[model samples]
Target: MTDHGPQPVERQLPTEEARDLLALVRDLVQREIEPGAAEEEEAGRFPREVFRLLSASGLLALPYTEEFGGGDQPYEVYLQVLEELAAARLTVGLGVSVHTLACHALAGYGTKEQQAEHLPAMLGGGLLGAYCLSEPSSGSDAASLRTRATRDGDTWTIEGTKAWITHGGIADFYTVMARTGGEGAHGITAFLVPGDAPGLSAAPPERKMGMKGSPTAQLHFDGVQVPDARRIGDEGQGFAIALSALDSGRLGIAACAIGVAQAALDEAIAFTAGRRQFGRPIADFQGLRFMLADMATQIEAGRALYLAAARLRDAGLPFSKQAAMAKLFCTDAAMRVTVDAVQLLGGYGYTADFPAERYMREAKVLQIVEGTNQIQRMVIARHLAGAESR
Candidate 1:
């Protein structure tokens, strides 16, 4: 099951159990999340009830092990679930991806005791999670972070500001990265900082271009105390943990991008077919039909890229390059497809009359977050050169 590039195969759909799960998820997403999504975005409200619905349905923990009250699905399957959620609402999909990324360090790298204590609550609780890696001055260069973490006997004292923290004020736990050594990537380390920890607080949410329903705030750790046991791995392993987690996180975002594109395409198809203009259905026009075909083609290619990367991950291979490729290609594809979708709808698309406007706004953030597309290209270039040299 190795894929060399973006050629998608028409393989069999999901099996019985997987299909049933997908159907259940599709229904839940459409019924529970889609209806209020626009209103929520307009009102700048988080979907607490929808989060509870997903948590209860086991979608929140879909990729985790079943041993700790999770759905125990593979990335290939879990990504589709995310795609469905994103199609319904971009905020829910991004929130889920951020939370899952937050859990990666603890679940995969934590000691058995740590996993036993923290994963269950994170996988299936009312509590949310946030990955605290990006800082005010250090985003793309994550290793250059300045947050200080000094060892204080059995506990660690952490003091720093974590910027662009999703679920910043609302999450139950934050996977925080701080400078534990000297200047450079090696000095950084990851620590599980509880939201309720003393000396820890969040600033008010930042006004953003989009994804308003998903809050983003800066977190302040003023002499925050952490147990030595909360460190994800050895002192310098924080970068490794964060990178590994993002390898999976990028795939999640790619899937969400596909969903965004799919949603836009679906809206376009419906709009064009029903929208009568010049005494004929707009979809009947050859020019408009060509654009629709291109949108669908790009989406199919994006799915193939992510799925190939997912298979590589499931097979325990080096997939950083593939992950980056998927994120970069799919996100850019979403941006183009969604914008064209809006263009196809004309005046209605510009206003709130269609979902394509929101879809376009949501598409912009995907390119910026989870390592900018520029960052993705750098990663891919390194991997390509590294491979060619080898």
Candidate 2:
């Protein structure tokens, strides 16, 4: 783990509007988000009402431009909103994050006409979006994706299946990456396809280990039709677009990891302080106290990593390496802290009586998504190697 001495807490210089936006998010999360987390997760139910609630609060479009009926919030401010939402409910946070990434492909790289056509519906219409980049044979090595899109007059027909899409069948639109040219990364292109287009279908969700409330399914595009105007950026720019979207999305996942870790830590601390053992509260023990300290330390560190990455994005600097570092570090820390929280609670932690069990399960997926921690290491090492590749 990248260790540094206990750093001072970060204080961001947000404008007044940004501060108010964050406060609004915090209030909404505490009031409406956390209360239903357990019930929704247990039932494997999507919280559609929660999405409407967030959209009404103006958070669903925080990352987009003001012209699109969005908040036009800075990346730094937007990530803080994600952190608060995630701290309340990870499923909802992930859904929002994925939608934001899907939107990124259009908002960041699309033509002005493309933006005018889709940004309003995507940003403020109370609808969800999905990114279709991964395939059955392509996860970490996303450039190997085999989904194809072929030109047919003024239209393009997309074929093949996308694996592990977050919104899957529920989204109104999808930002899909498919091979349009020869091979490797440079051949890929991104398209904006309506979810209800002919020949579009999604398989039933995969039985996941966690994030039960968020759907995950394979998106099948069997001759699905998309207009030429729906394409994002020029041909061969899709791979670069996908990678850039991931660089931002990684920060989102890292914020989520810290949220889950914080939730687990809170539960652990509360339980240890109240549960009596050997005629005293278990928290009275120095060993347990040290463990709690470590958990808190991990939470703060994870927060720092993602916030640092967000600050870089806000400053218009290169943050890809730092974003990967945040995702890798924070997810690993969440796994460690949540597992220990379970250990601290003994058998009770293993059971559903406490949220730590759920927290532990949630932490595992963060390591795997937005590129695996293994991929993160490769990304970091590649940055270190630069042009010196053997």
Candidate 3:
């Protein structure tokens, strides 16, 4: 495949170091990721080797502290790098996001001894991780999750199932939330369960509309035992930790959404500029030009929205409301822009020969993952109107 993806986006970096980091990311995406993205995704192949490369290059752990082998980049720079990766391929971009989410609980809340023991290996040791919260009976109302983790002498025994887990079967570790108290959100606790724990198993990956290369599956924990040392934060703190991670994770989704939309727009522009219709290039049509303009505008707005939220996070300011807004706007914009890209291509957009259709498909999951756009609206509303009555 030729290099026909979107050009590198213009970015405002906080430092010279950030600029160099973005340059390195663009080079990697061009040479390693973009070339085989469509073909590998079509074959349902996960790019484990590419992930290894990312791990080695320190791209996988950019936003964490450097004391534990992370790159120590701020969230602002980290999210832009994510946008660049996502533009090349959603699987790669989203995979990195999920991995970062998987690390959040322990990174944010783990005891100092725990961090010293486990954080370094996790950040750069090439060990993949998964976050487990939603169960078969619970998704949007995640606090109602039924997964149970019972304590015994020095160990916790985990039971029940986690649904829609990214990196389900292949992850080296899982950050799991299970009921350990009474009921609702406050009852949950988080644990770092080894993927190879006895009785831990995964079902076959979900057959999805897009992102076939990224596995999503259900994980079953039947009497899986974990040492108390692996527990992250205090008992009954898992829900809080999970929510904190989502605040950041939602921004990651927003960045990915813009990336996919940017890619689709690039493809649409390239096609219209070359293909002739009614004895002239279709790009010359006024109607088509307006559509292209709208698509570009939406992509830019989404980028700005996500970056604004990321900057708030970097400054250690309250950003939950803005995070929800960014997630809501950016993902919805992605869906609209990708759809328009498909329409601009007419029949070819529906076909597999062009990437617009694939972009459309990939854009859909962004609206659903992290939290659905509907859920984001509720979060923003809560921030504005206060919590709703039961």
Candidate 4:
């Protein structure tokens, strides 16, 4: 099987261990994931086995504390791993990101007892997880979510639907946010709901334009019962926890965007180099050459932006604004780069015969997920404008 694909990226990892880890990832991607990405994606099949392999190899829990089955790798290192996985297949990369987001509330805010009880299996025990924050009416305005949780003695009953959930039906656990008090952000609370709870169910997955292999569906909680022990963070602190998770998850989205852009650029480069036009390879044409150069430049810039944000996070510095910026720029760059890739390939790019069209389709959703690029600009602008008057 000839992999007429992109060359491996030359990454500047911070440590020899990180370098080794990336090398292992690259090898696995080339041999296992990349080969079947197009075929499976075309069939709209989720690669559950690949996820299992990632979990078994400790690749799934790279950024959390090692005390609870995680690799304790820095955010910088973890983001790069996401980039590599996304370059092979966006489903794998984004899936890992959402899983990490799902674990954030418990890992960062759960009591020691909760962490001791659940962190190990959630981190590395091959269990997949989902984060539920968005509802049908409240995506950008997340604080307006309508999911409700009511306490009954020591137990809580969750009701309402979570929309656009990744891994909706298949996840073993879900980190859910439900209104528990007044009618605003301060009212919401987080809970870890087991997938098989009696009244918990998933609607059919959405018919999406790209990344169809990744399940995106609506989850319903019909009076699902949860113990108080499953609650994450103090009551009324779920919105803050959700925002904190998004800050890190935005970096993951940025990395995934760059990876997809890089992959598209690589495919365009490979195709043009061997393709003949006017008695020579098209790569010799100055017009086409400039387009390739611009694509490469955008990918590099996006990678640098995301890495800078990741490093800030690793240093425990304030990085929310930078994270928003990275997500905005990288996803926009991916959309542009993938479109250029399609144009460079001419008619072939328009068809499913090549991956350029798929890349183009995949790049679009990046702008909309995690947070919309428009929402990202608002976030950045708020940081610049100082705190709101309220």
Candidate 5:
């Protein structure tokens, strides 16, 4: 089957360096990512080497400070890079996002000593990280998480299960939130635990519907010990830190959704142009052309929305509402556009012979991850209406 990758997106970058960075990313994606994405995804193989290459190339460290082995790129540039990676394969793109999410607490709240000690290796030392907040019972209601962290002198022991962890079994480190005090949001504390910590084990990876190349699993912390030095921020600040990270992470999801939509639209366009109809090419039909137009428009709109939210974040402004809106609109748009791509391809789209089917399957998960679209709507509503009355 012919693979139609997305066309180069004309990006408006802030500097010549940013343009060069995007060019480098596009070249890397074409050479290292897009070519084998279908085969690897089909085989349920995780591309750890690709992530290592990204780390060595400094791609994984963008949006972080250069003092700590980071690229110091703005969020706008970082998000565009994510779009390019996600256009080729979502596993890689979303993996980078999760790694960034894992680093947020330390980068934003950890002390100077902690940052100097850990940020360098985490940002660019070819190490992967995972964020642990959601548990088996609490996902959308993250504040209700039941994982416990019992402190004794200089050490803390964690005991609980974290579900739907993106890099559960394979990560080099994990940023975990566990209950440390009372009930509710203020009770949680964040800890940076090494993956090899005793009593820390991961169950088998979850059999997911899509993004098979990425492993999602349940992580069990059975008396996993972390030193006091590994704690991030004051006790009872984990929930707030997680929420802050999520605002940025949602924008990453939004960018990735646009990438998937763009890929699906490209596939639909390529298929329609070549596949002949009763009298002429299917691309000549008015109905299909309109569908293609809508797909392109939605991709463009979604991209714009995510970039707008990213810019707000870069400016050090409040962007939680905008991030929620972007995640909601972009994922919904991706779902609609990918379904339309499959419809435009007809039976071939339903079969594994074409990538339209895979895109559709993958698109379904975007709306569900990084907080469900339903949850995103609630966030946006809360921003507009102010907090719901108890």
Candidate 6:
């Protein structure tokens, strides 16, 4: 099958600059990301250089203030860029999202001095970051995280393991949430720890079914000392900080899901148009035509859903409920659309020669990451009906 890259998506960008930004992203994806994505992913090679290029181009900082080297674009624009990148290669797109999440604490709650000291490099410099919240015992029940931080004069010693950390071993810094008081959520506190700190180490990356190009591993913070200055937000506020960051991160995952779905639909369209059966192109078959129609419709709907949530966030409204709904819908849509794409390709879809199978494998993880679809349902329900009983 011919690799057509991602088809140009018709988007209603808010400004000429945003339009130009999308064009640039498309150009970059076509030239740099799409060609080697399959081979590199098969080899499990992380595209650190692509990330560095994105940092230099200011794509990594699009939603932050320009005062600290960010692009200052709205979430709506940044998400479209993420969609384009994800359509080309999911690892790069998701990595960008996680990096943005790692920076959220400092950008949103750090004092001016903290912002001045760290925001510039994190936003546009060639530094990578990881978010450490989930633990082996915690996962969706993040309020029960066991990582602990003990105070000692001007230093706080962190001791615990953080599981499922994206960019785990390779990040330049880590935004760590450690418990500083009693059990449950309020005990947690956020801290910024350098990657090469004395006792910080990472276990080997997990062998995953997809997105192998992105490493997911456990991070060990063994009495890793961080200065009091590195603490983010008020004490006992880490859980709140983490949840706020996740509200936005879920939207990133939603955009990525749509990107994957669009890629699959485009591939299916091309395959059905070119593949002939029963002495004619299969595109003439009404059944396959209807399938294609359904795939296209789902992709469009998922795109619209995510964009609506992003606009709500951009408008400074409470978007937590909308974000959860978008993540749940878009990821489920991606799973269905990818599965259909595979079925449409018939035997070819199951083979490594075609990308349908890979897309399917990658789509499974989207439903699980950021938050599980089950967790998303709970979040949405909580917003609608009120929090669940203890």
- Highest lDDT: give the candidate number: 4
Backbone collisions counted per model: 0, 0, 0, 0, 0, 0
Q: What is the TM-score of each candidate against the true structure?
A: 0.95, 0.95, 0.98, 0.99, 0.99, 0.99
Show where candidate 1 strays beyond 4 Å.
1-14, 387-390
Clashing residue pairs, backbone N/CA/C < 3 A, model 4: none
Q: Candidate 3, which segments miss by more than 4 Å at Cα?
A: 1-3, 387-390
TM-score of 2: 0.95
lDDT at 335 for candidate 2?
A: 96
For candidate 3, give the lDDT. Answer: 0.93
Q: Give the alpha carbon lDDT tens digit for every residue of 280-327 in model 6.
A: 999899999999999899889988999999999999999999999999
Please say which candidate is ahead in lDDT: 3 or 5: 5
Of candidate 1, the 10-residue stretch with the lowest lDDT total is 1-10
Estimate every model's Cα lDDT from 0 to 1.
0.88, 0.86, 0.93, 0.94, 0.93, 0.94
Name the regions of candidate 5 deviating beyond 4 angstroms. 387-390
Q: Lowest-scoring 10 consecutive residues by lDDT in candidate 2?
A: 1-10
Q: Which pairs clash in model 6?
A: none
lDDT of 2: 0.86
**Over the stretch 222-260, how does candidate 3's per-residue lDDT look in tens digits?**
999999999999999999999999999999999999999
Prediction 6 global C-alpha lDDT: 0.94
Descending-lDDT candidate ranking:
4, 6, 5, 3, 1, 2
Q: Estimate, for each residue in 206-280, the C-alpha lDDT of model 4 and write its tens digit.
A: 999999999999999999999999999999999999999999999999999999999999999988988898999
Tens digits of lDDT, candidate 1, 299-325: 999999998998888788989999999
